[model samples]
Target: MDSGAGTAVGEMFDEMPQEKRARIDAGGEDPPESSWAGLHADALGVVLRFLPCLADRARVRAVCRQWRDAARGRGVAPPLPLLVLPRFRFASLTPGGVLSAARRAWMPPGLDAGNACCVGSSDAWVVGAGQAGGECFIVNAFSHEVRRLPHLGTYDCSLRKVALSASPESAPDWIAVAFMIRWSRPELALWRPGMRSWRVCHHALFAGHIDIAFYQGKLYMLWKFTPCLFAFELGDDEHGVTISRMKDCFIEKLLPTTLGSTHELSCNMVEWHGRLLLIIRYYGGYQARHRVKVKVFVMDLSTNPSVLTEIHSFGSDCIFIGSGGCKSFPAGQHGGVEGDLIYFGPDHYNPHDAFVYSMRDGRTGPIFKPLPCVTHASERNLGFPVWLFPKE
Candidate 1:
C-alpha cells in the first residue's frame, strides 16, 4: 500500500473490521470434515457477509435453505461499490486504494463487459443501452437476471447516460432514467415495471453536457454549459413528464476555469445524505489527464437565488463520480476506503483516466496507486469503467 495512500478505519464500517475473509470452499460447498448446515445462523451470516467475491456469496446462498436465510441478513448500510475495471476485473476501494486479490465482480451471466456500454448503476442493478437499434436492458448482478427495455429503430443514437431511483432487489417501483441523444435531437427516456414502452419527451433542457441524478422524489439534470439545473417529476397519467427548472434555472455560480485557459469542465449531480451535490471536474483540454481540479457544491434552495455553494470538505463521507454512477458513499464501509475524498472515472478513450481527489489538502492522485494488479496493457476501446455495488 502507498504510504501516502490514506488512513484506515475499518471499524467504523460496521461492528467489525472492514476486511473480512471467509474460507470459501470450492463450489461453495461445506467441507466434509464438518457439518456446514449445522453452523449457527448468525455465524453463517457473518461468513456470507464477509465473502470477498459477490459470485462466491451468490453461490453460498445456493448451498442450502439455511445458508440462503443467513445470506438475507445483509450489512448495516450500502457498502462502497466495487471498482469494475476493464475485462470485468473488480477491485475494492480502500483507505489504501483499490485492492482485490480475489479481484472479481459479478455480472449477468451472458452480459459482455467488454462490448457492453453501461449507462448507469445503482444499488445492485446495471442499466445498458447499447447501439441505437440494438437491445437495451437492465440486469441484476446478484440475482443474475436481465429485463429487456424498449429500443428505437434506426435511431442510430445510444443512451449517453442513465440513473436508477432504486435497486430491483428492494422493490418493483424503482425507475430508470436515461439521457437520450438521437442525432441533434435530445430527450429524456424513462421506464419502470409494467410500462409497455419508455416514456420519452423532447426538451431543450437536455442540451449541453448533461448528467442525470435521482434525488428525494424528483429527477435532476445538470447542464455543464452554464451549470444550470432542471428537475422533472415522472407521471403515469396524461402528464407524461412534468419538467421544471431548479430555482428557475439559476446560474449564480460558474465554472472555476476562466477564458483563454486550456481546460475542460464536466459536472455530475448526486445526493449525499439529504443534500444534493454538484461536483465539477476540470482537466487539461487536450486529454483527460492533466492538472486535475475538482470542486463540490451543495444545492441551496433556501436562498433567494438558490445558488450552488462550493464546499471545502465532505466530512468523513466521500463521493464517487463517473460514467457508471455518481453518489456520496458512507465512511470506511468497504475495505479501508476512507472518506473526505472524491473518486473520478472519466470516460475518455484513455482507460486510465480514472483518479482520486482528496479534499483534505486538495490534490489529485492515481486511483490504483496502492494496488499493482491493474496493468491496462492491450486494453482498447474499453468504454466506461463501472462501479458495481452490492445487492441488498
Candidate 2:
C-alpha cells in the first residue's frame, strides 16, 4: 500500500457519517442478553438481503453471534455489479438501473488520479497505468492490495486493452496480456508475476483493431471487420515468455456492414462455458446521439477449418459487455433472465442509459432509466462504466 493512498483512505474513513463510523468501531455490537440474538437463521437471511454491498453485509454479520452464524451458513446473494467512476469512487445501480449513492474506494499510494486510468479488470482486480508513462500496477479492488508492474518503457503506442489469464489469487501462474495499437495494427504484449519486463510480439497478421481472450491456456485473437481468427500458444522457459501462432481459422461469410453512411465497426471476443463468442457492435449518427446495434456468433475451433455459427439463443448464459472486457455469467446465478439477452451499460460515448437487447426477438429497449448522478457536465471526466462482480 502506498503511504499517501493509505492516508487518503484513512481520511475518507474519518469523514464517514457518525452512524457508519460507530458501526465500524463497535463492530455492530448489541446487548449480550438481547433477544434478537435468538432469531432464526432463515429470518436472518431475509434481513441480509437488504444489504447489497459485501462490505455492508460483513459488518452486519458482526452484529451478533446468531447473525454471524447465519452469514457463515448462507452468504448474501451477490450484489448487482458496481460502476467504477472517476477518483476511485464506486456507484451502484439498481436492477432497474437507477444509480445509488457513490462510495469511495481505497486508492493505493502513488496512483495519480490525474494521469492514471483503468485499462482492464478481471476477478475483482483492476489494471491501471499512467497516461504520460512509467506507472503500471494491479489493484485488488476488494482487498485494496496493490502489486506494481514494470514500466511499459516507450512502447510507442497507447494500450488499447488488457486481459488477465487468471485472478491475482492464482499467484505465480497468472498471466497478463495487453493489446496496443501501433501503425494501424494490433501489438500484443505479455507480463507474468516477477518478470522484470513485458514481452512484446509483433505478428504480421495482427492488423486493424483486435480483441483477445484466454481460453484453456491459449490466447485467442479476433480482428474486427473480418472473419479470420488467430490462436497463440504461450509458454515459458530459460528464454522467458514465448508466443507461437497456431493455424488460422475463419468464420462463415459475413461482410462488414456500414453504420448508415459511416464506416464504424467494432468487435469483441469472450469465452463462455468453454466456448468462444464473438460480438460485433455497430454505431451510427453524430456524437450527440447515436443508434447502436449488435450481432453475436459462436465459434467452434475443434472443426478442421473452424466453424462460426450464428447463435440465436444464449440458453442459461448472459453476457456483460463494455470497454473493460466482455464476460459471460450464468443468468440464473446472477438473478438475470436466460436466453439470448445482451446487457449494455455506460461506455466511451457517455450514454448513461442502460439497455437490454434480445437476440430472440430482435428488439432493444432501455433497461434502466438514466442515472441522476451521471450528468452531461460530469460525463467527460468519468471512466468507462463496467460490470464489476463481487470478490468471492
Candidate 3:
C-alpha cells in the first residue's frame, strides 16, 4: 500500500480492536480565515451615513472586537448632521422602546424647572428654556453636552413664543435665538459654539407680533403687526441689519393660525417648497370629525409681495394628535425639511415609541427608547419636536 493508504489503514486497525472504525471525510469542512483582514474604514463610514437610525449603527459596534475597532476608527470622520426630536416629561412613550437621537439625555435639575419648554433644535443640539423668564439651555444628547445661556430676562413675557435657530451659513457655528418681549422689545442672542456665554442684542422692532426664522445668513423676523419680514445679519455691525418690507404682504391674514400666524401653511413650523408653511387642522368631515384634517400651503416669495398658495389638504382618520397616533408621550410641536419628514413626541404614550412621518417614503418608523434614568419624570417639561442640525 502507498504511504497515505498505509497510514489510513493503521488508523482503522487501531480502532478495529475496539470494534469501532474511524472514517475520514475529505470535503467535510474548510479552514477558518480572518473576516476583518481587508475591511476599510472609508467603506464603513459610507454605510453608517445611511444607517436609517442611530441604534443600528450602534449595533455594528457591538458585533465583535474587530468590528468595534473598525467602526470606531470610521466614526472619527465628521458625521452628517442628525435631526433631534424631544420626548415629553412624566409619562413614558413605551416601556422598553428605542430612544431617538434627541432624547438621549435628561435636562439638569437646575434647568428642568416645572415650566421648561423645548423651543427648537439645531444641528443635533436642542435650545430650551423655562417658560419665558426661565433660564435657557442648549442640550446636545449625543456628546452628553450641555450649555446654559444667559437668563432670558424678564423682557420676554411669553417664553412659549420664542424662536431659536442657528445661522445657516456660519463656519465655526453659532446659535441665533430670538424672543418676543410683548410690548417692550425683542431680544436676539448669539451663542457661539465654543463660547462660554451668550451675547444679546435688544431690538424694539422685533417685539411686535412676529415670527422668527434663520435663513441664508440672516435672521428673518416676520412681523404680524405690520405684517412684514425684517432680515438681520448675524454680527455686531450696525450696517449688517437690513429691513426689507413687503408691500401688501398680507394675503391670508384672515385665515385662522396657531402659535403664530403665517400666510403659507406647512408641516407645523417648516417651509417645505422654498416657502414658509402652516398646517391647518380642520374638523368636520367623517375623517376629520374624529381625527385632525391637514391642509398644507406654500408661500410665494418671488412675487413683489409675498402670497400664500394653497397646495393640498388631506383628511385622515389615522393621524390623531393625542390618540393611537403615536406610542410615545408627545412633547412640544413638530417640524422638518418641507415635505421631508414630520416628527413629534407621543406625550401620552409609553417611553419607547417615537412618532415620525416621512413625506418622501410616505411612511413612519419608530425611532428609539430612552434609557431609564433619561426618561424619568422631572420638574422640567417637554415641548414639541424640532430638527437640530449642525450649522451648515
Candidate 4:
C-alpha cells in the first residue's frame, strides 16, 4: 500500500515537471502587443490630462493623425480615469439628465442619457442604468456615442455602484457593476470592455450593501452594513476575485449604522493631491419642522482606519408644501467636481434649490447658473444632481 502511494505521488510529480513549474511561477512571457503603439497612445493621454490647458490637449492630438486618432479613439479607453457629471435639462417634464464635461479649467463635449440611475465613469467611458427599463448603456461622453452592453441579470437591478478599470500596460479593460436586490443580497458583476457577457462575482462578505472603487489594477469595495472593505485584484487568474479585509485607522470606527442613521451617506473613493481619499457625508436629521443639517467628512485611505476629518457643516430650515408634507431624504448620488469640490443631488430641505460645495474654497453655494438642460423648479419632485470629476 505504501509503494502504491509512493508511485501515485511520483506520477503526480512527473506530470508537473520543473520547467513547467518555473514558467508558471514566472507568470509566463508577455505578448508582443505589450510594447506596441498602444503604450505611446496611453502615455499621450496622460500628457493631455496634466497639461495646462485644452489647447495642449489639442496640440498633442495634432502631433500626428495616429496620435489624434489615438486621442480621439481613447474616448472609451479604460486606463484614463474620467469624472462624469449628470446635468438635468432645466426645461423637461421628466427631465432626464445630460452628462457634462468636468475638466479642471475646460469643459469636454456634452452627452445625453435617458433616465440614468447611477453612473460609473472611467477613462472617457461612462456606464449607467436607465430607469425606464433597467437597461445598462456604455457611453463615451467625449465622443457622444452610446453602446448597449449585454444584460448581466434581470431583477430590476438597482446599480448603486459602478467602477471602471484597465490593466496596466495596455491589457484588457473591465467594468465592475454592483447593485442591491431590493431588501436582500447585493451582487458584484463584471464585464470586459468588448465582451458582451458579465460574470457574477461570488464572495461571502460582498453580499451586503457596498460601494466600489478601482485603483492600481484592483477593485476596492466597502460594505455599507459593516465597516469591512474588500479589495479584488483584477486579471489575476481568469480575473478571479480574491477579497481581503482592509485594515485602517478609521475603519474600526466606521460604525455601520451611522451611515444610515442620519442621511443616505454618499461614499466616494477619489485621488486627491497624489493620495487617495474616501469622502463621506452625513446630511443631518430632523427634529421638528423639516429642519435639515449636513456635514461633510473626509478620510485619507492611505493610513490605517482611514483617518476621518470634517470639512464643513451647515444647516437649513425646510417646510413641506405638498399634501404629504415634510419628509426626510438621504444623501442622493454624489459627484466630485474640480478635484475637491463636491456636488450633491437635490435636497428636500431646499427642494427648489441646487447645492454645490467646494472643499478647496471652503464654501457652499446655491446653483443659479441657468442650466439649459434642467428646469428651475420641478413640481413633481426635486431633481437629483450627479457631479462628474475631471478625467484629465
Candidate 5:
C-alpha cells in the first residue's frame, strides 16, 4: 500500500503485542534463508506492492525489523473488504480467481469481536459495543486502536445502529451518531471519542427515522412513517453535541416517490460523488426469500425542494451496503470490476448468502463468499459479519 492506500493496516503490527513478540523471540535467530529481511528497501517496496495476499504482506512485515520498517505505512489497498466474521476471523475478498487472504491476531487484548455488537462503520473503523465490557467503542481494524464511547446503560448491540461523521485519521472531530432505542422510544445518541457520556436527543419527528448518513458536515435522516427528510449538525463544542427539533430540513420533502412500509421494504442512504443516493430494496414481503428488485435514486439537493431523480448508473463507481453504513468506491481503479453495482447482504435469511445488485437490469447475483463454507455461521451464535473497507 502506498500512503494513499492508508497507513493504519499497513503498520498494524509496528507495536506488536508483548506475548506474541516473546514467542517470536523464543524461536531464536531465524535461519539463513530468513536473509530475505535484508533485501534492499526499493526491492521490498516492489515486492509488497505486487503481493496479492494481505496476510502474506503482513507476514513479510513481521519477518524482521528492516522489513517491518519497509512494510510500515505502505502496501496495496485490499482489492475488496476483509470479510469480518465472528471470533476475529477475516476472509480477505481477493476479487476473482485468486486465493483469499487470512487474518492473523486482529484485535487487542480485550475486545471480543465474536460477541461485539458491531453497529456501524466508517472507513476502516468498526463502531459497536464491545462484548467484554458492554461499552461502545470505535476500533481500527488495522491498528487495533480502541476509542471507547460512553456507557450504554441497559442498551446493547442489537438495538442500535451508529455512524461516524468523519474518519479519525483525517479528522479529530470524530463525531458518532447512533439511532437506537431508549426506554421503549426511538432516540439519538451523539458523542465523540473522549466524551463521558452520549448526548441523548429525542425528536418526535425522528421517531420514524429509518436510516441516516453524514452529508457535508450535517446529519441527514430518512423517516419512514412521515416520508420526511431531516438534517442537523453532527458536531460539538465544549458543551457537547447540540440538536434542535426546529432544524428539520424538509417537513414533507419525500425523497422517494412512493415510500414503502417498513416491513415490506428497506432503504440505505449512501453519499455518492458529493450527492446523496437512496437505495431501496423491495424484498417482496416479510417472508420473501429473495429481493424482488432494487432501485437507485440521486437526491438532487441542488433543487429547492430537493427532487429525487432515478439514475441507472454510477459510471465506474460501486457501492457496498454493509451492516455498518453504505460505502461508495471507485471500484474500477482497485480491480477489474465494473461500476454502477451494489454489493448487498450476507442475507437476513441465509447468513452465508449475499448478492450483487446491478442497476442496469435490476437483477441480483450471489455475493462472493471468498470460499465455500468459509462464511457459514450460526446467525445467533455471534455478531453479524460485515465488510471492513480500508481507509485512513
Candidate 6:
C-alpha cells in the first residue's frame, strides 16, 4: 500500500478503543517472537483474505515487516459500498447494519462541498462539478487525489447528472458524459480526456428531466414520465455522436393502471447482470414529505420487439435506489437478505429516514437507521447520501 493508503487506515484505527488494539496485538494468545516471524506466506494470505475492509487490511499491513510483505503478495477484495455526504464526510454500513462515520482527512485542499454536486461515481472516483461556476473535476474519495477537467461553460448549473465510461486509472481514453437541463430542456454532452471542449448534442427528443447511465459501451437516457429511451453509441466518429431512440423499449405500457393519475413520478435506469432495469417511483402528496410507491421493470431486449417485463423478485440481487443513482449488488455479498428487495431513502430533505420495500412479499418498513451526522434540522442543508464503491 502507498503512504496515503497507510495514513487512511491509521486514521480509522485512531477512532478505535485502546482495549480493542490490545486485543488485536495479542492475536488471540501470546506467541514466541520466532513463531510469529516464521508464519508462512500462504498462511498470512489466508488471514488477509478475511479482512475485506480496506482499513482493516491496511492496519494489518502496518503491524510489521512480515505482515506488510504478506499483504503485498495477497489480493484484496473490493471494499463494501460507502455512503458519501457533503463536506467531505463518509460513513460505512457495517455488516451488522450499523452506520459508522469513516475517517475524514482524505479530501484535497480547497475541495468545496457546498457548491459541488456529485453527478457520477465510477472506479471509486467521484465525478463532481461546481454548481455555480461550471467547473468539473474528478477526485478519488479515499486517496485524496484530484484531477481537474475542463469546465462545462455556463451550463454547469443546468447539469443534473454525469457518468464516466472508465476510471482514470484504467486508461486515458475515459469519457465523461453529462446530462444537463437548460430552459426545461435536456441536452447531452461528452468529454474525452484530451478534448479541448465538450461535444454538445441538442435534440428535441432529449427534452424533459431524465436520468443517464453508461453500460456496455453505450449511453442510455430515460425520460422521467414517458417510457421513451434514447441510446447513443460511444466513439470518436460522427455516427457515435448521434442519438437513436429505441422504439421498441417502452415502459409505460407495463405500468399498473394506478400510476396513470396525477401523481408525480421519478424514473431510474440501471444495468445489472447484463440486463436493463427500470425503477419507477411514485410520489403522492404535493408536500415535501409525500407518500411514495415504487415499481420495478426489466427490459427484455432479446425478444423480437424488446418488451418490458415486470419482475416481482430479484432473486439474490438487491437494489439501492437514491437521487444520486441506482445500483444492484448481490445481497449475500453484503450480508443482506435475498429475494426482491429495495433499499430507498438517501434523501437530501429527509436523510434520517430510510425504508425497505420487499417486492417478493409486498412489505415495507424502516430498515435503514439514520447516521449520527445527519440531524433533522440540518437535513435540508446537507447534501444527499451518495453510494460509493472503493477503487480496485
Tens digits of per-residue lDDT, candidate 1, 198-241, equal: 77767655673677788787887777634677667665665334
Better of 1 and 4 by lDDT: 1
TM-score winner among the candidates?
Answer: 5
- Model 5, 85-149: lDDT tens per residue? 44445555554422253343346666655566666776778776754236676788766788777
Model 2, position 216: C-alpha lDDT score: 78
Off by over 4 Å in 6: 1-69, 72-77, 102-105, 113-115, 155-158, 182-185, 235-248, 259-264, 283-293, 302-304, 334-340, 345-353, 365-368, 371-383
lDDT of 4 by residue, 1-392 (tens): 12133222112212222344345437583223322345477777566445423324544643433455576545431121112223321111010121222221111223224345434544445455654226666554433356566664565555554565641113454545544343355666766655556666665666555556665555667553333555565553454433333332345365445445656443434443333445454444322212323333455565654665664421221111111111111111112113333444442223333444554444555333443223335312212333332233
Each model's number of backbone clashes? 4, 0, 40, 20, 5, 0
Clash pairs, candidate 5, are 1-74, 1-75, 1-76, 120-324, 354-367
- Estimate, for each residue in 234-261, the C-alpha lDDT of model 2 and write its tens digit: 8886656768547677563443344424
Candidate closest to the true structure, highest lDDT: 2
TM-score on alpha carbons, each prediction: 0.75, 0.76, 0.51, 0.49, 0.78, 0.75
Model 3 lDDT tens row, 7-54: 222121121111121121132332243485356767766665554333
Q: Candidate 1: misplaced stretches above 4 Å?
A: 1-31, 35-78, 85-89, 99-114, 238-247, 252-263, 284-288, 333-336, 348-352, 369-382
Error of 2 at 52 (Å): 6.1
Clash list (residue pairs), candidate 6? none
Tell how far residue 212 is off in model 6, in angstroms: 0.5
Give the candidate order by descending TM-score: 5, 2, 6, 1, 3, 4
lDDT for predicted candidate 4 compared with the true structure: 0.41
Instruction: Give candidate 1's TM-score.
Output: 0.75
Among all windows of ten consecutive residues in candidate 2, which has the lowest summed lDDT? 6-15
Compared with the true structure, all predictions reach lDDT values of 0.62, 0.63, 0.41, 0.41, 0.63, 0.63
